[model samples]
Target: MASTPVDHSAPDTAARSKVERFRANPWLALTAVSFGLLMVQLDGSVVAIANPAIGRDLGASTAELQWVTNSYLIALAASMILGGKLGDRFGRRLYYLVGIGGFVVTSVAIGLVGSIEGVIGFRALQGLAGGILMPNTLGILRAVFPPKRFALAVGIWGMVSAVSTSLGPIIGGLLVEHVDWESVFYLNVPIGLVALVFSAVVLAESKNSGGRQRFDLLGVVLLAAGLVALVFGIVKGETWGWASAGTLGSLALGLALLVVFGLYETRQEHPLLPMRLFRNRSLTTGAVMTLLNFFVMLGGIFFIMLYLQNVRGYTPVEAGVSTLPMSIASLFASPLGSQLTSRLGARVTIPLGLLLSGAGMFGMLSWSVDSSYATMWPPFVAIGLGVGIVLPATAATIIGNAPVRDGGVASGLQSTMLQIGGALGTSVLITVIAGKVGSSLFGELTGAGVPAGVARGLEKAEDAVTMGIAPVSGDMPAQLRAAVVEGSGQAFVNGLHAAVTVTGVLCVLGAAAAAVFVKGRAEEARDMRAQAEAAGEPVGVVAAH
Candidate 1:
């Protein structure tokens, strides 16, 4: 019957089939998603390396430079849930595309603007875009991959993140030294373009179709405001004095807003964050552990960069090269963690990861101005291995525990916790370093044999000292200059030692908590199925369309 209607569109038909095949391929979707994820993760690590250059170019103080990183993280942490909710409500593919596009544009703006204030503003914008993109990437994977394969996809996703993070310092160091820091920002353009193209062609749109159409806008506002206030208070406290009324008031307000947000979320029929998800003990513990894990990773990396380049007088490339062990370790550790988690359970894997990380942090206690390469590489490898192991396992636990309908939200929540932990890590650790440096600078300078007058004069540049930069003048006598450098290095190392100690203890405590609280695979799977069944969600494996 259709023989008469055989039109001459064979080539078009073949092209359309090819397009559909590409669109349906899960791996292509992953590849497209990875580009964007790589861009964001790479930017984060690279910028840490570029901070010294940014400060010199823009005349930024230590606090101001901290703002550059803090602003992006805070913005990301605040908006992540909202971004996830929006993707679930709208379409994941659409928002993902928009997010990547916005991120690229904002990155360009950051480079063109050429001012610290402008950089801070654009970095926050870039973060907002990242928040929108990040959770949806996971959501898309959940939608496209069968339930059985989701864990493997997540492992691959974590691997991409590890790789990008590992590459960032080296790429950024090269750009900053050989070219200019702007190149790091500009690097996003090409990767983002590729992502946009592939994602447009390959990703099939998906969303949470089971939910009511209504949104919880108030929850978004409350959460955003609360996170901003908390991060602001922490970042400013370093400069404003923790006892200052501004700091005290900001902290109080933030805590109060977050409390209100929690109470308000429980009342909503369509909450931004479903309070019920926390009912799973494994999920709750995983979220907290994820936070603590990143707190150590991001915070430790930030200071480690400073220590390598500033205190130890390594060039940017040398510093980046030095960190290769950590990056390489993570690259292998991620897949290994996933495999171990599958066999031994998260309860065993996560704490084991944390122990290694904690041990790595403790290793930093031995660091000094004259610390050899031999001294640094071991801790770098340990922390990298630890972070890599925890990342995918915690992600799997958190996302796997949720009802499939809440995939986007769960993904967003996971990313939110990651960013929040990172934000807190960077701000809190820097505060520890700054405060320690401020208090000890005078003694260190004097002890190094600088005259009392010279030492007192140098105290005015405490901001510089905190960054591991000796504020030595060109006109200073050679012997005096050497003393200042020695004193400054000692003071910075003192701060570094203090900061790492705090993080190391926290990591050990987190390991203990994970061991005590996290459920094994079988228990988590049973509870997850039970929860989904009770909620009337399909309790069995769901396949991609």
Candidate 2:
């Protein structure tokens, strides 16, 4: 839900009471908030370690292992819009605790299961819980934190979540190495339990009925199914063969469903996502920019993580640490977004952020087998700074521009776009990398001076080098495997360049869109205060679209 300033004494008193309760046992509240977030973050990483083990244990083919991750992400992207709406319609606190509780239970079940099918089923459940928690985590911060400190509170929460997710792969690798993959799932139990208890004690229950309580079930289903179809089409396209009927049908059907969703939403009395929100220039631009922006960042990270571990010959820990520079840069750099808006205005901020991001991606195209980590900082720094600037500036514009009556829908739209965008980005990158690996192996074999007759045996060797198969392929000879590694690593570097090139193109387009859509700051803030006054609500909270 979008944060709105309240003029009501009762609600303000209630907010103060919660704050006072927090001060009395700040650790408890902090623990509750952070742990709830931790479970959400942990799930993002835990599966990386389990991919191989799950494949082996379940007698699954390579396709099944990818499904294990895809199912969760698909559900998350699909359900998040509804999850945010549910929180607004019912209560954010209720959903927060329930979501975490559901997540913990499903995670334990996933770990205890011995079957691949069962694990996929439970992972879907976990994603449902995640969809709930993901949106509400911000809603909780908005409802609990006072107006003056809202930005700082949300910033800290965002920082912690980012750090935890970055650490997930490293932690998962350690647990699988030392104990078992199940330990990663088990790790969430304590954290989940603590969040549940402390949240019950310290966090006050809150909701925004906004004069509507009915669930938009039809709209929800249409949007969700559309996303799943679209994501499946992209994520599984390479593995399934992009030209295959299954892949094309999925994409076509997804497109059709989204069209239906738009048509139906326009007719509904209380649409899950109001079609009218798109009428606002800032809301439309902000949401689109976020979609395109995260598509680059999330996709880049997916490829980069794989490159670091699979191609660059780094351990999980090393990969995690290598990314720390971007993480740090993001924190120190986000407010530049606000500053850009304050000085040159949103028109300038949006385009500037996109240009910065695009330039960063273009710079990353130079990666090679001989690339150094020390040289990696500049591209990462640019991307990080670009993101930091994009999120808040777009957010200020989007929410600042949207109507109060549609705040829930507006918030849901932005978040849903983010989830769907991230899924698409990650899936697209995976698809691109996998496709290139097969071709790269054949090309490498051609270059290696190997005879065509020898490819039957040598192909496995040459292809292993090209396909990034060595991290898990332990039985190969050192010389042969090293050659395979050399070939595969180079292919991945090329994949990075392609992915980065795409990012740069999309970001530049997004920048142009932002320049047209967002409002000037003085006008935006004044509009927000005026809307608050008209609504008989508090001042200084929301800006008008």
Candidate 3:
């Protein structure tokens, strides 16, 4: 059952009879949905860039710094399924508008927050709103365009997303340089407002049009707590030994809750996640690939932002602009990559794309105190092209295999994976990087010209450089500062090297997963049409050539 081209028929009496069918106005609906939902895509991409500025402005400690990114991502992961179910039960457009409005308002709040606590709280609300918006975008797209044009519309949506991804750093950088970190949040206000106003005018509401459905409140709480605890453990594990009580406790509790979640989901009628979805090899593998790709993509980006600012001594603007070449390059590669997906097929394209990302990540290992833009550009280009190639095709796989009845849930699961993987990636990499920093104590002592005798004394596991603050230990004066600088710089370099290596490996695994497991596009579409026909749902006229 291969997917044929869309049966573009004239507005026949039969074609025009159905409310759901994509008729002469289908593209109109598609465009409106794309524009209306643009804010979520934009926020996911741009918001991370403001982290450094926010930290400085609010005088955040190390632990609280991680919250700047994770708070939004963690809440988004927890609530996405619930949002999708709500969209299915109620009108998607209603939830969509509410979610978009919430995002706009919260972005402004994040901009205005004077304390780290305020930022974290608003970020959680923003994440919840973003969760509601993401699944709705795909659902609305399906409701608008005929099945035939769905891929193209989705492709464009992905392109905008890539654009948004690239936007975060650049926009955040610019605003931070010219105005303040608050401006980055402020920019979203207008863009979101514009999208919100237009959507109210042009978008149509669509839903399951069925009976009431149960909301999984317990599952939501359990899952949110589990992820927060798990991520908190990962981000802090380097500081608190993995064997320490706090680290062990969070891990045990998080895993236990997730286990309970799996058991509860199966027994519930109309479960938030139907176990049957996992039965499809394509869905399982596609979701895994999606998770893996997003993991490396986000991890690498977050790490680079830190590297650029902390180690490279770049301003926020410089760090933002540094990524511009990659972003701009992706703008062109993204569309071209979509065309390649149909031609080469997923097997060829997915692997090739990941291989490119791996190569790019490996290229980043060349970064050092002596390095310049030259060392960074090649890898950035590789990642941009690779990411652009994988995104659209991966999306098609996710949507292609999902049943129309469970569209919102399926889409929500996919969105959850994207956000969760990203959150987890940041958490994991932060720990790894911190470990690299802590272990660099010896190198810093040696590089700073500490006497072999003195350096030997510095070997205890505590912050040895700061430990040098002892009166007897402070005699070296200039040597102590030099050692600290060398150590800190090398620590950053070491962490970047380790992080990129991890990202490259994950990208390879993701590529392999996509190649081996994802379904053929045509087979999925055939299954969808067959299921629709069997359910006594209107299948619409499969347009005559």
Cα-based TM-score, every candidate: 0.92, 0.84, 0.84
lDDT string for model 3 (1-545, tens) is 99888655756656555533433255665565566456676666666666667788899986687677668776787777778777766766788888888888998888787899998999989988988888877766655655555566666767777777777776666766778878777777877777778767666666775467777777767766776676566555656777889988987887888788778888888776677777777777767766776777777787777777666678766887888777776676666665666665556667777899899999988888548889988998898888777776666566656665566777787787787667667767766665665577567656756666665665553232221122223555676756655655665577667778888888888777777776666765576677677655543211111
lDDT order, best first, reads 1, 3, 2
Evaluated against the true structure, the overall lDDT of model 2 is: 0.70
Candidate closest to the true structure, highest TM-score:
1
Candidate 3 deviant stretches above 4 angstroms: 1-26, 33-38, 44-47, 214-244, 444-450, 453-484, 521-526, 533-545
For candidate 3, the per-residue lDDT at 125 reads: 95
Deviating ranges (above 4 Å) for candidate 1: 1-22, 51-67, 114-117, 536-545
Give the Å shift of residue 515 in candidate 3.
Answer: 1.8
Off by over 4 Å in 2: 1-34, 144-149, 209-213, 334-349, 403-408, 434-443, 448-467, 470-484, 530-536, 539-545
Looking at model 1, report the run of 10 residues with the lowest lDDT sum.
536-545
What is the clash count of model 1?
Answer: 0
Tens-digit lDDT track of model 2 for 163-242: 56656777887887788877888888888998888788776655653564567877888998998898888777756778
Root-mean-square deviation of every model: 3.0, 6.8, 7.6
Model 2 TM-score on a 0 to 1 scale: 0.84
Checking candidate 1 for backbone clashes, the offending pairs are none
